[model samples]
Target: MNYEKYYPIVYKQLYYLVGNNELAEDLTQEVFIKYYNSKEQIEFLGAWLSKVAANIAFNYLRGEKRRIKREENILEEVNNIFSIEDEIFRSEQIKEVRKILVNIPDKQRVCLILKFSGYSYEEIHNATNIPLNNIGQFIARGKQKFVKLYKKEGEINVL
Candidate 1:
C-alpha cells in the first residue's frame, strides 16, 4: 500500500470529522496502524481506510463527550460534598465499577464501556474492531454479566 498517497486524504477526512488538527493527526496515524496490522488483503484499500478513519474520529468524539460530562459530574459532586468520608466513599465506588469491568471479557468490557461512554453502535464497533451487527449483543451480555457479578458481590450501586 502507498501510505504517502493516502495520508493526506485520510488526515483531511479525520480533521473534518474531529475539527482538530492534533486529533486528526493522531487518528490518521491510528488508521494506518490498523492497515499495517491487517492480516488479510483489503479489496478497496482507499475506501476502507477512509471509512475506518471516519469511524475512529467519530468514536473519539463520542468518548470525549462522555469524558467531559463525567468530569463535570465529578466537579459538581466535589463542590457539593463537605466531608472527607464522602470523598473516600466516592473512591470506593470507582473501585467497585472497575472490579465489575475486570470480570468481563475484553470485547464485552469494551462494548459496555463504549456504550456507557455515549458511543453509537457504529462507533463502538470501530473502536473495538467488533462487527456492527453484534455490538448490541455484546453490550447486552456485558450488562447481564456485570449485574450478575454485582449481585453476587453485594456491592452498593454507585455507578
Candidate 2:
C-alpha cells in the first residue's frame, strides 16, 4: 500500500480532532510510524489509522486539561498567600491608626475611623447620630488631629 496516498487524509482528520495544525501534523507522523513498526497486519489501513489518531488526540486533550487545572491551582495558591500577607499588613496599619485615634477627641475619632472603614458620610451620620452638616467638619478635624498625632509618633509619610 502506498501510505503516502493516505497522509493528507489522515492529517486532515487529526487536524479536525486536535484543532491545531502543528500538533495534528506531529500526531499524523506518529500514527504512520506506529503503523510501520507494528507486527500485526492491518487489513483496513485507513480505519486503523483513524482509530489510533483519535486515541492519541483524546489522550493529548486529557493531558492538556490536567495541565491547565494544575496551573489554575498554583495561581490560586499564590493569590491566597498574597491575600494573607496583605491582610496581616492591613491589620498592623489599622492597629497603629487605632492607637493614634485614642489621643483624639471622641467625636473626631469616631468619624475618622468610620470614614477609613469605608462608610459614607450619610451612613456615618446615621451611625453616630452626628448632624449631617457636622459630619464633614468632624472628618476634617479628625484627619488633622490624626495626622498630627501620627507625625508625633515619629511615623513619616502618612498615608
Candidate 3:
C-alpha cells in the first residue's frame, strides 16, 4: 500500500483535533503503522486510514477531557479545604502558641509543632526518625511545658 500519499491528509485531520504539529505527525505515523499491520486485505486504503485516524483522534480528545476534568476537581477540593477566616484564625492561634513554644526544650518543642501542624504520631516519627513509642511521651511533655510557660508569661504580663 502507498501509505506516503495519505500522510499529509491524515496529519492535517489529526492536527485539527490535537492542535500540535509534533503530536499530529506522530499520530499520522501510528495510523500508517496500524494500517500496515492489519491482516485483512483493505480495498480502499485511503478510506480505512481516514476512519482509523478519526477514531484515534476522537478517543484521544475524550481521554484529554476526562483528564482535564479530574485535575480541575482535585484543585477545587484543595481550595475547599482552607477558607480565608479559617486560615486567619489558625495563623493567629499559631502565633500565640509559638511564643510559648520557644521556652520548651528543643525535642519537645519540635514534637508539639509537628502535632499542631497536623502530623500524626506515626507521621512525626517517620519524619523525625524518632521512635514511635517516644512520640506520645514527647508530645505530652511538650504540652505540659507549653501550658506552664504560657501561664508564667501571662502572669508576668498581667502584673
Candidate 4:
C-alpha cells in the first residue's frame, strides 16, 4: 500500500477531528500503525483510517480527567520541543492569550489559532466550517483581546 499517498488525507482527517495540529499529527501516526497491521481487511483505506482515528480521538475526549491530563502532557511535550526558555516565553504569551480567549468563545479561539498560525481566512473556514465573514470578526476580536491582555501583562512586568 502507498502509505505516503494517504498521509495528508490522514493528517487532514485527524486535524478535522481534533482541531489541533500537534495532537492530530500524533493520532495520524497511531492511525497509520493500525492501518499497517489491518491493511488486509480494510477497504477504502482512507476512510478506514479516518474512522479508526476518530473513534480513538472521541474516546479520548470523552474522559474528562484523561483529557485534562493529556492536555497537560501535550503542553509539556510542546514546551520541551520548543526548548525550555522559548517555551517559557511563548507560554507566557499563550497563557495571557488563553485567558482572553476564554472570553471570546470557542469558535473565535479556533479562528485565532488558525489565523495566528498563518492560515488564510478561506483556509480557516474550510478547516473549521466557520463562515467566511465570521472568520474576520472572530480573528479581529481575538486579536484585540490578546493584544490588550499582552499589553496589560507587559505593563505589570515593567513596573
Candidate 5:
C-alpha cells in the first residue's frame, strides 16, 4: 500500500545519510522489515519509518562504517568538467566536510546533513525527532561548528 509510496522517500533519506547506494538499499530494506514486523502497533507510519531510518543510519555511522562514502561512484562524480587542480581541491574539501560532519554533535549533525541533503525542515524534524521550533537553531549551530572545525582542519591539514 503505502510501501510503494514511501519506499522511495525512505530510500532517498538513507541514501542521503550514507551516500552509498548498496548500503542505503540494505538499510532501507532493514527499515521496512522492522516496519512490517511492527506495523500493527504503529500510529504514524511515515514518521516512525523516518525516525527508524535515521537511527539506523546514525548507528551505522557511529560504528566502523564511519569510513562510508557520500556518493555511489567517485569516477562518475569526478568525470565532470573541471580542471585537475579543481578536482583535487574539491576532493579535499569533501573529505574535510565529511570529517567535520562526523565530529559534530548528533542532533546538530543530523539536522545539517538532512538539510544539506534537500530535506525540508519539517521532514528533518520528523526524521530526527527534533522539534520544529528548534530545527533552525540546531542547523545554525551546526553550521557554526562546522565552519569552526573546517578552519581548524585546514590549519592542521586534517584529511
Candidate 6:
C-alpha cells in the first residue's frame, strides 16, 4: 500500500472533520491501519480510506465519555508535576476567552474559526452547509464581533 503518498491528503481531510489536531492525527493512523488490514479487499483505496477515517472519527465523537476520560487522565498526569506561572496565566486567559466565546452566536463563531483556519469561501459553505452568499456575511459579521470583543476586553472570544 502507498500509505505515505496518501497520508497528507487523508490527514488534511480528517482535520476538517474532527476539528482537533491530535484527534485528527490519531484518526489518520487508524485510517491507515484499516487500509493495510483490508488492502486486498478494497476496490478503491482512497474511498475506503476516507470512509474508514470518517466512521472512526464519528465513533470517537459519539463516545464522549471516552474522550472526556482521556482528557481527564492527561490533565491528571500534568497536574501531578510542578506548574509554570505562564501556564497558569494562559489557563486563566483561556477560561476568560471561553466565557466570552459562550456569548457569541454559534454560527458566527464557527464561521470565524473556519475562515481564520484557511478555509476558502467555497470550502466554508460546503463544510457548514451554508449558502455561498451567506458565507461572506457570516464571516464578516463574525470577524467584526470578534474584533470588537477583543478591543473591548483585550482578550479573544474563543471556546
C-alpha TM-scores of all predictions? 0.51, 0.77, 0.54, 0.39, 0.44, 0.39
Q: Which ten residues in a row have the lowest lDDT in candidate 3?
A: 77-86
Off by over 4 Å in 5: 1-82
For 1-159, candidate 5 gives per-residue lDDT tens digits of 499998999999999999999999999999999987873788788999999999999999887444445343564567663567688998987887898889999999999999999999999989988899999999999999999988998788755
Ranking 1 against 3 by lDDT, winner = 1
lDDT of 2 by residue, 1-159 (tens): 667898998899899998999999999999898888999978988899989988988999899999999999999999999999999999988888778889999999899889988999999999999998999999999999988888877545543
Q: Over the full model, what C-alpha lDDT does candidate 2 score relative to the true structure? A: 0.90
Better of 5 and 6 by lDDT: 5
Model 5 per-residue lDDT at 116: 93
lDDT per residue for candidate 6 within 1-159, as digits (tens), equals 687888988898889988889889988998887776663777778887888888888887879768899999999778754366668888998886676666678888888788888999999889999888898898888778866776777633332
TM-score for model 4? 0.39
Model 2 ranges with Cα > 4 A deviation: 114-138, 151-159
**Residue lDDT tens for model 3, 31-126:** 988987899999988889889999988888899899999999999888877676689889987887778888899888888889988999989998
Candidate 4 deviant stretches above 4 angstroms: 64-159
Show the colliding residue pairs in model 2. none
Computed on alpha carbons, the lDDT of every model, listed in order, comes to 0.91, 0.90, 0.88, 0.82, 0.89, 0.81
Each model's number of backbone clashes?
0, 0, 0, 0, 0, 0
Candidate 2: worst 10 consecutive residues by lDDT? 150-159
Lowest summed lDDT window (length 10), candidate 1: 150-159
Q: Point to the candidate with the largest TM-score.
A: 2
Cα RMSD to the true fold for all candidates: 27.1, 3.6, 14.8, 23.4, 27.7, 23.8
Candidate 1 lDDT by residue in tens digits, 100-146: 78999999999999899999998887787898999999999999999
Model 1 vs. true fold: TM: 0.51
Native-to-model Cα distance after best TM-score fit, residue 122 in candidate 3, in Å = 57
Candidate 3 residue runs with Cα over 4 Å from true position: 84-159
